[model samples]
Target: MQAWRVHRNGEPGEVMRFEETGRPVPGEGQVLLRVRAANVNFPDALLCRGQYQVRPPLPFTPGVEICGETPDGRRVLATAALPDGGFAEYAVADASALLPAPASLDDAEAAALHIGYQTGWFGLHRRARLQEGETLLVHAAAGGVGSAAVQLGKAAGATVIGVVSGPGKARTAAALGCDLVVDRRTEDIVTAVKDLTGGRGADVVYDPVGGDAYAKSVKCVAFEGRIVIVGFASGVVPAPALNHALVKNYSVLGLHWGLYAAKDPAAVLACHDELSRLVAKGVVEPLVSERVALSGAADAVQRVADGATTGRIAVLPAGAGAAR
Candidate 1:
């Protein structure tokens, strides 16, 4: 099988190489999948840099989520068991982790749905308890995970304020159902959000970018508001001032969606059901901005790592042309 592998810890473009490799054999409790489309996630770049939580031994494949086909011709979404990841033509996934691909989405879109959307669903509904008619603020609102939050927040009837880095992403966020879009590069996030919300501030803050973004959220968060920390996409992990949170009477919640898949699989399934319904209704659509062939997987991952992509990018590995 043809696959891309990282032989050393480095930037994805610097270390990832394509080569013919032996097909990965699945062991007990696992299923083998013929990769159809694999989404290039930021973690792929972190894995390449040896910066992610779980680093595979040297010479590993990095794709985490994929839409795959079984030998029986069933289409499913699966998490690539590291080392034998979805970057290849074939990969192994735990049978328990496989989900039926939503009929409404294409392979690339299905591949994008699992991680980003799941994170947003869990962060907004399960953690922050975002309420209908309330204002929700999303950071990095044009990126993969942030865009998912925008869609879900709107679907739940919340007025979403999306904070993006540029005009292009602000347009994308508006198209994704954000009631208001704030360009962070030129406008002040806290001020814009406050002005949009009539000075009450956001009732719920969905922060995927930590550094300055998190700090700014603190300034504009409403009283008794809940701030859900999804990730540190800004590459700086900021320590929250717990005293300020206490004095302000707001809550800060940390969300790691993967833990639900292990600790409470039922909750994960429930979230999937809701996401699937939204997909079927066309209420939530994964924004796949670019689709690259397997040959360009490494570069796409690098683009995501460099924060240069506004939406999802999927690698088509089955000889199908990548869609725009």
Candidate 2:
């Protein structure tokens, strides 16, 4: 087997080395999965840099999400157990956490679906309780996590306003069903959201990029509006002023989707069922912008870390032909 390994904490591209290695052996209650398609996420970069919440021992593979085939030929989606992640020919995962991959989606798209979509579903629908006809504001709306929130918001009948950095991402967000697209690089996000909602501001804000994005969100959030914080992709975590939230009568909620796997497994399963239903209805699809071979895994992670890519990037370890 072959995998990308990190020997030291540093930038992904600098530390991730591709080399030959033995296939990982599954532990008790774990199953071996033949990697079909591994999704490259921003966390892969963080893991390489030793900044992620869960840091495995050195020389571990970086991919956290994968679509793979079980020994009995069941195709499933899973979170790769650390120390032997999905950036290789084979990886191990807890058998109980495996999810049925939607038949309608290809291996790459299925691999891309789990974490990002689940985070969006839990953030917008569960935590924020976004209502129909409400105005939803999504930051980084063209990226993997934000794209899922944009589609889910639209599916829930909310008027979505997507905020992105450039003209290219603006077009992608518009195509993803955002009623209005705001280019934060050129336009003012707070002003745009206020104008779009007739000066009332947005009813719900889904923020994956914290720091400045969170700062602006509080300014335009409506009275009693909810802001769901999913991640700090900007590499800066914001210390929010609770007084602002109190005076404005708005709520700021934090969502860490991974904790649900252990805290409430049933809810995670239920969310997957709902996401699968949406997939069947064609209401939600993983926006996979690039499908690279396993050799490109390190570069993919680096690009995601630098915020240089849009949507999801899937790495097919067995090559593109491995995915149907």
Name the best candidate (by TM-score): 2
Looking at candidate 2, what is the lDDT of residue 64?
A: 93
Model 1 sits at a Cα RMSD from the real structure of 1.5
Candidate 1 ranges with C-alpha deviation above 4 Å: 320-324
In model 2, pairs of residues that clash are none
Q: Quote each prediction's TM-score.
A: 0.97, 0.98
- Where model 2 places Cα greater than 4 Å from the true spot, the runs are 319-324
**Residue-by-residue lDDT tens digits, candidate 2, 1-324:** 989999999999999999999999999999999999999888898899999999999889989999999999999999999899999999999999999999989998998789999999999988999999999999999999999999999999999999999999999999999999999999999999998899999999999999999999999999999999998999999998998889999998999899999999999899999999999999998999998899999999999999988999999986532544
Give lDDT for model 2: 0.92
Could you list the CA RMSD of all candidates, in the order they appear? Answer: 1.5, 1.0
TM-score (C-alpha) between model 2 and the true structure? 0.98
